[model samples]
Target: MAARLPPGNQRHDGEYEDLLSLWSDLESALSVVLSAPLRVQDFPAKVRQVDRWLQDLVAHDIDAALYLMFQLASTSSVGYSASHALVCGTLCHIMAQELQLPPRERDSLVRAALTMNIAMTALQDVLAGQREKPTAAQQDAIRNHPQESQALLERLFITDNLWLDVVGQHHASISDRVPLASQEPHDRLTRILGTIDRYAAMISPRKSRAGRSATDSVRAIVGHEVDQRDEVSYTLVRSVGLCPPGTFVRLDNGDTAIVLRRGEKANQPLVASLLDRAGAHHARPGIYQTGMTNKPRIQSALARSAVAVALNHRTMVRLGVYAAAPHNSGLMGLVTVPGAL
Candidate 1:
């Protein structure tokens, strides 16, 4: 079980509080939809609510929001589908902002990313725990999930063409076989979603495989033939930085730390020190600004297997690694409070 946040009066910026609350609401909404037997009638409303929050974050505190969402990817005990949706939505929003996409287009992408896997929510959760390759039945479901998700959305009254189109084509690949001239704007959106989806999934751990290292995942995405020309790929790599949040790294000073946020430089990111030079876990991890010359610099991104220590979300929050963000101060406390998870 996850640890509870210690009781205290924590101060945070209002924007951070709002974003945390919105994130909680989204989790609750998704939990209900995924666990219940009937389709959630208010699913569209929930998507809109999350869309508004994403728009707000993009407009005001995007970096903090991205960090929070990435942290949630590990901290969230919710099944894979909910966590993946949140991560994908956050990444889509960040990439869209980097691309300077118009507000309407950005929101549509966010919405599409959030709901693209709705049809296979339960199956995704099941797959996360299975070590073998998917069965033929599961394979068929995976192949048709995009269209099924779109149909479900239509039944729920989602009328935006952009939202519908992006959701439907989310799994579609851009092929050398298909002429680029035939691609539409929605296809571009699909490419963005696909790139982010695969990248996020690769970095996330599952029963079948340990998650890829941050640097390795970036290299894979950048090296992909289909994604080589996709600007979204570059934007994702830049926005998340070389050491994205939640990634573990070894420092030049012989300490191990988990990245907390991106810094001005791609390789220099904010991090929370976990192990000291002697390789002992600290009682309380210290947040460091790797961009500062006096601070220890990152030597390399560490693979998951290389780090033997087990760090949980509650511990990360209690250590204040994520607390530096103006809006994030009180969130960790709130998220770990009794029953909050």
Candidate 2:
């Protein structure tokens, strides 16, 4: 059953609707650029336009951007390459700000991320839907795609050496023990992009397997078992939280909730419960701000495959906006602010 949002939540705000529309448009625009760069008249200009669009989207409201990105990545109707590029590019943009990367370096890093897999675009889409392991030839192609992508960009008249070099070495391995600040500019960006690339891929699903839960994915990247957290991994966790919005969590009280926003604290995200302890759908999902006093805390992250709720994401996003609104009275006993908790 589709759980209805509560009465006041039924309506959408114009700004929220605009944000959704903007994201949808950006997705389409990016798909065009990534899928057919040769066909684009002014390729570099087009890339910049898309990058500016992404920056604006992220700057407008990062939580909304993450909510939409994770939701698309989990259940993408588009090709895997495009979806993956968007996720990587978005993360790069966010990381740039968090890492305080200089303007030129950030530009090169993000552009490289968006174009890194261009050489394998079709193959990537095919691989996502193929249950079987990659063939030997496909493996070879994947191994060679980074350099090929760089060469292709050069042919397309991209004269940015930093951008080209970053794409070429995006898959290069640097010692994890090395400090990011000590590396050359290109190497630092490469390390940052490489870490974001892996993290993005792990959370996205494919026919071959279900994607890991966000927490598990982060744990893998952060190397929690070995207790060696790289700067990129630490920054990622600090910026996006262990479970960002658009992911799911199991609560201590036995309800399954979808994350709506990053709370004042990372672990205490604002979530809306779709299923009760009995595993039945609720008529109206209950909103809970977890980690307040610790009663209804999150027990663990849930993989998108683990929960089968079909969400009305716009409505969910609206609930988040309302929760953050300055003048909103608490709805259905909802706490308006995490601080209030």
Candidate 3:
């Protein structure tokens, strides 16, 4: 049975519809850019498209944009490169906004996040499906991917110094003994991207293992070698919360649910119940405000292996937990935002 939004919840049909359209357009553009054939000429145009989408995204409710991003991350059929780019971009945007960065700087940070892994897109996809450890050659490629990606962007006529620098330094460790004065002006942005990239990858399922629980992922980030004392790390943690969207959790009421959105409180979030107290699937999923009462609060974040249910993009869209366009109009149906072109 398809899940429905709770009865009293006001439907943001128009907003969600727009979000769906935007998501498809961005996904399609990213697919072309990341394809094996290397559409080098199309790279610049696609970045512009992503920039426009980011602009429009910030104008909407932050939570709505986040929900759309989570839906895309969970449902995308694209390989790790594209999916990671999208997720990291969204996370960077959220953190930047929370930290009150200037609009120009925020947009540049998102652009950096989106293109940071372009050079390794295909390799990442291939590596993700393998159970064995990466080969020696693959290890070398992973180590050099940041510089290689930046070089590719430069060849594509990307002239933004900040964007290029952020991509190049994304993998550099803050825990290194390098002097702070030697760090680039955009070091903060790089650190934020690095943190988000790692977090997103940890929570995303791979052939080698199911994704870590959201709580565990958060813990890993806090315990990272790079000091967590920076404002960027603090804001990233605060914005993502303990139970990020797309993570599954068990409720105090004995129902299993998927997180839909973060709440005012870090421990609480909005979730859609997939199972009832008796451990049976609901005819229609129920939405709960975990912060409203402690009785139905999230008991613990569950790993992907623990959830046996099959929830795909179409089902999530049908449930209204994720946004979707009314028809399969592809990129043409996407509404043009002012100044996007």
Candidate 4:
């Protein structure tokens, strides 16, 4: 389970505390929706509530939102299905802004991403924690989950045609070369959601195997396409840097670091080094701007499963806040508590 903040007295300030509280609340809200949609009095209203919460979190700080999302993806106590949905929905929300998608389409698109796997939520959670491959019945269920999900949503009174269509066809095979603008609305949304879904899945860990590195996950998605101008995939990478916040990496100088924020360039990001070149943990992580001249560059992405370290997330986030806006020198005075996460 993701850690929670202590009493307000123990926290440095409201900034980090509020961000962590928002993430915790979001996970709990989503857990309820995905695990038991029927239990919700108004399914559509509940969805919109979750969406607004997500928007608030993202608007507060996109980097911080991504940081928490990736952190949860690595160690989700709620369940894999919920974590995956949150990642996909969050990415879709960001991509919607990049694509300048209409508000209506963006709403349906993000809602679809959140509920696309509703039909198999229980099964997905089980599969994520199990070592064995899917049984034949499980395979059949997986193959038909899209259609089933749509039907389930309908029963829950989701009457939005665009939402229903996108959920039902999110797994459809579409030509990557076709420009997103020329495609039908449902088709375009489906393609976008599918891309994000696959990318999020590739970077999320499961009991069957360790998740791929963020760099490798992007390559696996964009490499196969012959079209260099694939709108969704390109915009996705542009919106979130190659090594997005909360992901780990090895530096050219042999230090292992965690990404804190995106830099001026997509390839370069602000990172905090946790270990030195000799593989010894630093007493306190040293922040670096990989984009700066003569600075150590990122050597490679590290899969979450590959790195085992407990971080006082509160301290790291304070450092991020200070790094993003150096004028906030007061933030640096926050207490550094150990074993917070």
Candidate 5:
């Protein structure tokens, strides 16, 4: 969890403290080739080094791990394969906490999430960037990715079959059409990874302009995952959607907010609470509790529809709110909106 500040000064502290550092690590790692040659060379060693580092960090700070993973998921472009692993890790952390999953299970979940896409860095970059679809070479690379990722995992001595299974079957659907010898069970990791992969593919602004808001994106992803064959998909996607990156919200008491962080708890969207009536600036790291209610009562109610109702930027604004306005005439925040006029 982030260090908490007192009630009134919340606006000053911002969330995602280590976002840059995490981004640096993510970009740096993805910059290297990890498929065949690199794997044969020393990329596997580098991958293990990073994983070991992350594990050491995770033992003490899951929140930091989550923060790192979230930023990586939202911004990293070297490859979605790598991006997928990070997103999965972030989702697992948040989901595990919400589901009250066991610690060992949570650890396993995070480990699997991180390594799932290591073998598909090429395809990952294609998905993360505006690059052309994986070429015949990339396609050939992909069909063999399970083997590639597994081979790397084995080389790295990653012990869990659970990790291998999710990493291997990520693109595989349960159609009898697949000549595969057997199938895997529906569980936390599969659900989390599946959803993260689909959502990442959809919201990639690099993909198209039909860009959807956080809520809309969640709705769309959840809808896509609803078929009987895709219940786990639905659950995972729905869970992640609860707090898409950059989600803005309002409290019941006329406060506007933005989601700066997402915890393992699907219901709670970690928000940066804006204190000013106009919402020009927010208390950087202000976080209210998750769910409909909170441990400590929220002082102000956010106005969702209020934004639509042109803020009465007019001078002599609502006395109760405008009392603190800079000028006696009434100045909301720094500038008055046309609506105020």
Candidate 6:
């Protein structure tokens, strides 16, 4: 049965719609190799299945696309680099779609996403047990996988070297001096995709300090040359609720919401109400727009339990008082924010 979201969930419609689409596509693609051994030789064929899905994303609501992509890539499990590429590519497509870029640019974003994590599969096996502690080199390798993915893509035959080159240099800081050995062509859309591709990976939940809020993530991205920071920033901000993506937050108005939707216009995100401190849903699954409350709004996107336990975190720092633990784990499915947040 198609999973139905309860009413009162502000983002339930949009998020759930996107999720259903993504699940249908992912299931169809992964099913081909579900029984096959997990190996690189079989990756291309499997990825080809995902190609139709990427092509389908060409016209989707970009915000939903990005949110869905982030959900797929930034999980604790399924840390394979290949998975990263798929997710990242999906994100790039969302960015392109949002900007209404040309077909070539959209295609480039998909190609780049598919290749960015080429090296990740090699290291994905290592991620299984290192959820808590990772070695310096492991972390470094993970960070540099873009380059590693490029090299691997070089060995594999691809019609366009442009994507591999972009994937290789995707992580290259705008200030990096080494003339990247890249010659693949690109248009404005392609460049934007490349930029978003890198940004998505950077601000992902586990990639950095888990506490980094979406706003900070946007500021960090502004350092790069991507245009219209306001749009991307707001999209990320509004997509998730008062709680930033990856971080858990409780709102005032006596409600506990998770950051699942980003808005390019406001400060608050489209939050999905999970529980109240007393363990009830005072508010429905919807957006809690965080505005200039005449109080100190807890803006930090920190780990939930840690902050709650260590600091004795109370209910909605900005609103009134309503706090609880997260419950619903279903994909937000890229639901739209109901202007309220």
Clashes of each: 1, 0, 0, 0, 19, 34
lDDT of 3 by residue, 1-341 (tens): 32233233235544555666777677666656766425556667778777677657746655556656665554433566777787788888888878777776787788998899888888888887778999999999999999998898888888888899989889987642333235555886777788788888887777777677767787787763334345555666678667776677999888998876677776787777887767677655666668784448888888767776766433343333332223333312222221101
Which scores greater on lDDT, model 1 or model 6?
Answer: 1
Ranking by TM-score: 4, 2, 3, 1, 6, 5
**TM-score of candidate 3 to 2 decimals:** 0.80
RMSD from true fold, candidate 6: 9.3
User: Which regions in candidate 5 have their CA more than 4 angstroms from the true location?
Assistant: 1-23, 26-71, 76-81, 96-109, 131-134, 155-159, 174-192, 207-214, 224-241, 244-257, 261-270, 273-341
Off by over 4 Å in 4: 1-12, 224-228, 327-341
lDDT of each: 0.72, 0.84, 0.69, 0.85, 0.48, 0.47
lDDT of 6 by residue, 1-341 (tens): 11334445446355434554665466345433322324446565555557666656534434344444544444433444444556556655555555565676556557666656556654654564345567888889888887876776666655556666677766554422222123234433334455555555554445323423444445576653323334543343343332443344555644455554443334455444545556544323443534534532334443343322211011111111111114544333222232222
Pick by TM-score: 4 or 6, better one:
4
Would you list the rank order by lDDT, best first? 4, 2, 1, 3, 5, 6
TM-score per candidate, in order? 0.79, 0.91, 0.80, 0.92, 0.54, 0.58
On lDDT, the stronger of 4 and 6 is 4
Q: Best by TM-score, which number? A: 4
Tens-digit per-residue lDDT, 1-341, candidate 2: 22334456534555677888898788778888878889988899999999999999898889989999888888763488888999999999999999899999999999999999988888998999999999999999999999999999998899999999999999998766788889998899999999889988998899998888988998887765423347788788777878899999999889999888888776788898888788787766777778877458999999899987787676778777677666666444432222101
lDDT of 4 by residue, 1-341 (tens): 13333344244447667888889889778978989998889999999999999999999889888888888886653489988999999999999999999999999999999999999999999989888999999999999999999999999999999999999999998777899889999999999999999999998888888888777898898883324578888888888978998999999999999998888887799998888777777665667899688888999999987777777665667567677775554443443433322
* TM-score of candidate 4 against the unseen true structure: 0.92
Cα shift from native, residue 81, model 6 (Å): 3.0
List runs of model 1 lying over 4 Å from the truth: 1-10, 13-22, 34-38, 56-60, 75-78, 175-183, 224-229, 283-286, 291-294, 303-341
Model 1 TM-score, all chains together: 0.79
Candidate 5 accuracy as lDDT: 0.48
Instruction: Flag clash pairs in model 3.
Output: none
Among all windows of 10 consecutive residues in model 6, the one with the lowest summed lDDT is 312-321
Residue-wise C-alpha lDDT for candidate 1, range 97-205, written one tens digit per residue = 6777778888888889888988898899889888999999999999999999898888878898999998988988864233323556687678888988988887777
Superposed Cα deviation of residue 10, candidate 5 (Å): 14
